[model samples]
Target: MKKSLNELKELAKICRGDIIKMTTVAKSGHPGGSMSSIDMYLSVFNLANIDPKNPYDYKRDRVVISHGHTSPGVYSALSRLGFLNPDEVIAGFRHSGSIFEGHITRGIPGIEWTTGNLGQGLSAGVGMALASKITGNNYHVFVLHSDGEAPKGQIAEARRTAKKENLNNLTVLVDYNDIQISGRARDVLYVDLFKEYESAGWNIIEVDGHDFEQLFNAIEEAKNYKLGPTVIIAKTIIGKGVSFMENRHEYHGAPLNDVEADKALKELGVENDIEKYKEMRKTLPLLRKKLEFDDYVITADAGTPITYTKEDKVDNRGAFGNAIADLAKINKGKIVAVDCDLKPSVKLGKFEKVSPETYVQIGIQEHNAATIAGAMSVCGVIPFFADFGVFGLDETFNQQRLNDINHTNLKTAVTHCGIDIGEDGKTHHEINYIGIVRSFFDTKLIVPADPNQTDRAVRYAASTLGNVVIAMGRSKIPVILDENGNPYFGETYEFEYGKMDILRKGEKLTILTHGSVAYKAVKVADKLKKEGINISVINVSAPLEFDASRISEYIDNSHIIIYEDHNKYNGLMVEFSKSVVENRLSPLSVENLGIDNYSPSGNNENLFKIFGLDEDSLYEKIKEKINK
Candidate 1:
């Protein structure tokens, strides 16, 4: 039997109580926003055609929480719906080893995407909706957003894209709960979200977020609409249930103590809350069944491999494109490539020729491309997005950050990384791609040394189950390993996260580098060897989380010279120094050879020489430092 409005409201109240109690016990979480959005959450979970028993089922509708700070509310609703055990929800908030983190995680069963970075969920939702349309699936994607976060530029960009594309399967719900972390949202950034969305070609609906019937009706209406996306502005009060906490900024992220918890429970007519919680646990299994776990597999038809000749020296970007085409031959149905109008330069045009239907030519919209990739990932497809490293990383860092938070498993192939992208000037050069991506723990940064490694990295990224940022260079590098050679080939060197590959062994100086700069280091080491200076060269591919223990033995035996195609401040220089210090490796004297300052417009040779990143410059630097 369908649940009545009163029953839904009662359930929403129960959820609010659970949220407050959980956050109070954890002593840290956003309570106000959670409380305000309880009714809206209850309405959707109750009315949407979502199956908890088959959470990953392809036919199931998707719900993306944009206002991720209100994780308490989402956890409460998911718990009440039986997606997780009530005890797990109560015991796991901000706890170590608990999947129920302060923010949403992909570990949670029913969550379509992990989110916390604001203003990104809508874009991701658009992608999911687009995927549904492309694949002929009849599922709707609903994105819940906070009012204050709507003013971000990406939000506008996403809205414009949705409108232009006529995405009717997408719906955006704005929790117009006046208050944010500081004060009223309007006071901080006045936004007529209803009018803004309407002007952008979205069908706007305003409703009392606390009203279950109204919210349910709006959702039903949205599903029936066939023109464009819908935006439901849900006007709600911050901290709706608790009298003292209502409409207050202080309660946004504070945990109530025992005494306050008692008072809050008393207001809800649940004087003996322990008994109530015990009884609710019995009904938790019903909610768990709604989270489905059916995995759908799509196979691609076989196609001829576009083999490259030995004489043709191509850039990593070109090799990545060819690799994508190879992937399309293997998994055509579930693999797609998106490019930001730089398809010709990024070499994604090759994939487009092979799989025209699977390639999306999103012109000059890196932000849109990322969200599209996120959406496609959610729909059981692998998306490789390509662009220049500077535009792809720095310009759309927030989009990728949110993708990581969402755990979208989107693979980004960023070309022209670091000062090696010469003559384009400093504005076009990307020397900080690794550092920026490394800052986020969820993202894996892969800097392949050569074309073969680039192919391997692309294939690995396509099959991996998390968000990835593959940094590639514009220049063509010589193949370091022979095609028949097996350098650590059989011994499980399969792109383990945080593991480094030792290319050459020597007892003198240790040359640590990655990407394009690592090649220069190898040349420099060979030059030094001719003059009786045998330097060990290590290709440290995984930048974010390096294996200190595996490389600790080598650090003590040699003086380390870290070379990179990036700035010295927060790039590889600092990372190497910190690693040595933390491991307490005999206080080794390390010399950093990298682009220490802004670069100028010049050829690749001039730029590398000026920054001391080329073989000649690096050789001189190492010689001078060692001689002294």
Candidate 2:
């Protein structure tokens, strides 16, 4: 139900008071921007088709606050509109124990996206808008950003994507307060926001942000515009309701002192209740009860797994392409693949051919594409972001981190990882992916050893929930074969995540490897066995997880060989050593055969030999260890 203009005016005053009280009580927050953005937040929350009781309703509109430092404004607006309790918000703002942190968080009622880092929210909105078209949910996405973030290149990238996708279901409300922490926005970095939006083919509207009638009318106009996404440039005053702090850059990030807050409250005719909230905050629990939001339900049908034989001579990327194409055919609208103009290289061309409508081509914009894929995953669509490891994991690392923070069900398939990428050199080789993903608590990483394993991993990732990364290299390696000369990851082999695949069992020593190096390890073991040195070889696809029990049986005098095409400091070798110590296993002299430094661009085979990771080098190293 839309509130009347007079009713909205009265509510805005209360919300303004709430914003002031919360910030003043917290003593650490951006009050100026919050005050400036409060009225617009109130107007949108009241007018949007959102139910406070059923805040996570699938049919409801999504609201993203890009400038999350203005959390006081968002919490106040949501509280005033019945989405949260005003008392809790005022008492818990910026409190360590509360869900109401300094920045806005998702899974909180009425907060669609957790956006403290600026300029990414628009891309998130574009993703949701694109998901609306894919899932036919038809829910509109409204992103409220600030003028301080107008100069970001990701915003420009998002604008182009929105226009290219013709996302008429998206609208952006920019709080053009023209004030940043340093000084005036124009002086900080002049960005002609209106002209930029106009150039991006967006319908533009200028309105007074504090005026209820003008804001309401502009929003209605934007909702009705059919050409493309709309941007409402709302002119706002910093410190809107308080005269003492109005238009002062000092108040942008600094909360007013107690005396100044009291004077400002008196000026706005709002009671100064900071002391009461301050006392209540001290009694607040360190950890609040978990807030309930709708859980992500996987709806896509993971098609039958594909098996590749030794004669297939296909790369892991090719197997991924086939698996995703198969998934797209079965899942149809439920699955989408996001590509960063590397369709041919990343092997998403097959997926594009199978389901062209579901394949998104975001040309050369990995940052924007990464964020879009993450946001799309949560909006009832299983999005797989396919790109080279350098772009997908290394270049867009922060975006991937944000996706992890959002707990998105994004399957990131990064091909051409490690030195197997060959001539692309150090710049293209992604050797630190294991370390990068280890930082995330919820995200899972899978390094498939062969085409057969890659196929199963892709299928497994599709059927699974949460964020999963299936990393592969750029070589046509042979399929991993069992002792009986059949495919190791064959028809009957299910892809159990975090389980090590012991390809060859022996007693002299154990060889642990994954990805492009797994087949080489098995061959090395065979050669050593021929020379009267029987050694076990294990492929650890999930390097992030350390299960000491899986390898306890193969610990031959604690003499293990850790060889991989990854950085020695953060790869499986480090993981194995940590697990060994943590699990209280007997210490043994281990030979770490991993990349110690970057190599020159050449054939992958030659590169391996240069780095002393080839089959012969590994065989000799193992023999020397056994002889010792």
Candidate 3:
């Protein structure tokens, strides 16, 4: 059943035709790169240890295409290898109702990680390779990337990690075709791939990618490499087969027309079948097979949710570190934390000390770390990617966005969120975590008010499935107190997703806040209580998912004041406003209070005062508005 050299060469020709036919029918896609990388695909699919029949085999090799725009090539090669139907792919490439999306998507039988954004695929492959080491599996991970994406900083980060971990099970095939969407890849951006890979301590294998023998031999040798990861820097043409298209940048993304397709098909000795696929595209099912996701979920022994008493003052991140450490201690391989050199800042010091192996220290590589954590999280490990909110969310937004699309079970915990991370200036202060996480439909955002809630939330996230972002501030704060001065999120409180904790109840107005500001809201409510200015304080831990129905009574009569340390135009205020209109609930008056502009570098207290986010500011603002 294995493909011989002659058979592979012939199959390669047919696959080239398939790629062209599919792209021509769709009137879009990267046929040039696909054609360039086709031999590598066939080589991996044929010579590699993978079963098309049992595509998701546990020990089967993972094929990750980093430059996913070459999806036409991937689909065609997989179809030839029996992973997908040839005709379906030809008609459905980038179709509105097809699984053959513009970029390669996971859950499509042969695809491992869904990738479109460059520089992430190598990290994803490194993650799978790391998992193999951790789980003691012999499976190898193969990532096919383009030379154009070699300049991505995250790829450099991934290279360092692959070397540091000594991941011999990982092999990368770079389609060094030298041409990109622009002119020559070197002209657009010069990346010395050989030097870089060698510097990263990678075993570099140079080969003519079009030669089946060289490709297969290189891949086999890469598998036999004992030192560390191998990079098969396949020197190739931009368009390998078609004479006119070869090394041409215009053909990179543009699909050939009918006349050009006819000429190309004739050159490859394949039939001009564009019209056939175009007709088939009309009758193809409105919806293809629904994506089969990785059903692996981590069930941690979510030990007793620790309750911080009113007397104990702690930062939410410190509590998170404690709780995550407890989880890592109890559950060995079931839980892991991916750190980007911010162990002390993110308070992952405890987890690292308790379970060192469980702590993945990929330094200063937030994009790669985010992606790697996402990959590992899907592979039966609950990976908590901890970092500053700015680095964790803002810098690595696209990586997280892909993770959302993949629907990975990742816990992205960020400290130094909002103006609370003062003196670091606007750059370090991540004031829009709520806004960023709101974009992720699958990811739930939790801004825990205090140490107790942080502990409970971390525990909850560990037990639960799907993506979650636990956003917190840097500064330490008092434990949020109930009406009787007892801890609000205390012994009896089970951290629920959408439910809000009413710290104190008042008749005149309600102040909605979370994270470091929740305890401050409690103080404001308590202050107002003495002067007969009874104001309610509600701690909205989960800003993304709020059951307005549960708090309808609080907002119906009381003037609602939204307070936080986030962008006023794009944070909890906007979410709450949308919720009010959607739920058709009426509050006396709605006012949004938060950072509308960037504050200067100083202590958080001064920053808060400058932004009018201090306890006194909220108290006075409430009095002035409600009294009117």
Candidate 4:
């Protein structure tokens, strides 16, 4: 039920009081911005097509709190509107024992995308808005941001994309309070926000943020506007309610003291019952039940796996393209392919042809693409962000990290990984992908050995939940063959994550390898076996995790060589060494035969030989180790 203008005005005052009390009790929060943004929050939440009872509905309107530091205002407005308990939000506001974190979290009631890192929220909102168009859902997306984060490049990228897509269901309510951590937002960054939005083709509406009626009307106009996305630049005063705190930059992030809070609450005409909540804060549990996000279980039909044989010489990127395009055909609009101006190189042209509506091309905007894909993943879309590994993983690491924090189900199919892209040189070679991906706790990395394995890995990543990176090289690789000259990752092979595949059996020394060099390891093992020096060759597709039992027999008290086209310091060698010690498997000697430093532009074979990772070089290294 929508509240009357008079009723909303009264509620805002109470919410203002709640904001002051909560932040003062917590002693750390951005109360000033919260106070400034409170009236707008109250209006939007009331006007939006959202229900406190059915907040988890996929079709519900998404309200992304981009400036998540204003949680006091968000929680207070939500509590007053029946989305949360007032007392819990006040007492548990930034306590280690409570879910009410300093930054707004997504699992909380009424929260959509959890955004604290400035500049990415708009991109996330754009993704959610695009999902509605692709799925034919009428739900709208609203992102509440601030002028303080206006100068960020990702925000500009998001604005252009929104306008380019003509997202009529998306609205951004920017809190133009003009104050930030240091001082005035204009003095800090000097971004002409209105001109920026105008140039980007957004429908702009300037309004008084403190006026409930004006905010409600602006939102109503945005909801009905059909040309493109709308941006309501709300002019507001920092610490709006209290006269002493008004326009003061010091109050931007720092909370008021207890005495000041009491005074502020008294001015707002709300009761000062802070003593009771302060006591309640102490009694809250250190650990509450974690919020479960199992609402979006993937139901798309992952089509039949395509197997490549010895006759088919293809790059892993080609295999990825075939698998993802097949998935798009089978799932239709449910599988979205996001490209960062690398559709041709990343092999997403087929996917675009099959599902044009779902293929989002965010040209040269990897940061925005990464966050946008992450947001779309939660909004009933299986988004696959395809790009070169350097751009997708290296340049957009921070965005990907934020995606991981949001626990988003994003599948990133990155090609041109490692030096296999060769002549592209050091800048293009993503030698640290394994290290970068390993840093994300919830993300899994799959480095497929050959074209056949790449196809299976892509499908597996699409079907799974959480973040997964399917890293592959640009060069075409031969199909890995078994003893009978048959494709090892053949027709019947079901890709089980974390399981090691032993391509060749031996006894002298064990060689562990993945992706760019897995086939080389097998060749070396076969050649050594021919010379009466048997050694085991294992393919570790999922480098981040593995089942110790699968490879324990080969490494127990035996010499081990970790060979790969990755940085030796933090690649598979580091992970394998930890497993050996943790699983109590004692290896006689472990050597790392991987890229120790960057190589110059040249053929991948020459680069491999230089880095001691080519077939012959690996064979010679194993021989030397065995001789010792």
Q: Identify the runs in model 1 with alpha carbons over 4 angstroms from their true place.
A: 23-28, 85-99, 134-136, 241-251, 254-268, 272-310, 361-368, 405-407, 477-512, 518-540, 543-561, 569-591, 619-628
What's the lDDT for candidate 3? Answer: 0.89
Worst 10 residues of 3 by lDDT: 290-299
The number of clashing residue pairs in model 2 is: 0
Report how far off residue 235 is in candidate 3 (Å): 1.4
**Which should have the higher TM-score, number 1 or number 2?**
2
lDDT of 3 at 355: 83
Off by over 4 Å in 2: 296-299
Q: How displaced is residue 309 in candidate 1, in Å?
A: 5.4
The estimated TM-scores of all candidates read 0.82, 0.98, 0.97, 0.99
lDDT per residue as tens, model 4, 1-628: 6788999999999998998888888888999999999998999999998888888887889899899999999999899988899999999999988889999998887898777899889999999999889888789999999999999999999999999999999999999989999999888889888999999999999999999888988999999999999999999999998988999999998888888888888888889988988899989888877877535536467679898878898999999999999998888789999998888899988988898888898999999999999999988889999999999999999999999999999999899999899999999999999999988989999999999999889888888888999999999889999988999999889899998898999886888889968888887777877888888989999988965566788988789888889999999988887877788988889889888887899999999988988888887788788998
Clashes of each: 19, 0, 0, 0
lDDT of 1 by residue, 136-190 (tens): 7878888899998988877887898888778888888889998888899899888
| Residue 619 displacement (Å), model 4 | 1.3
Residue lDDT tens for model 2, 1-628? 5678898788877777887788878888888999999889988988888999888877788898899999999999898788888999999999887889899999999998888989899999999899988888888889999999999999999999999999999999999999998999999999998899999999999999999889999888888888899999999999998887889999899987788888877887887888889999999988887666895446567778998887899999999999999999998788899999888888988888889899999999999999999999888889999999989998998899999889889999999999999999988999988998998988999999999999999999999998999999999999889988999999999998999998998885888889999999998887777878788888899998868767887863657888899998889877887888787776366878878887789898899999889988987888788777
- Worst lDDT run of 10 residues, candidate 2, spans 291-300
C-alpha lDDT (0 to 100) for residue 2 of candidate 1? 43
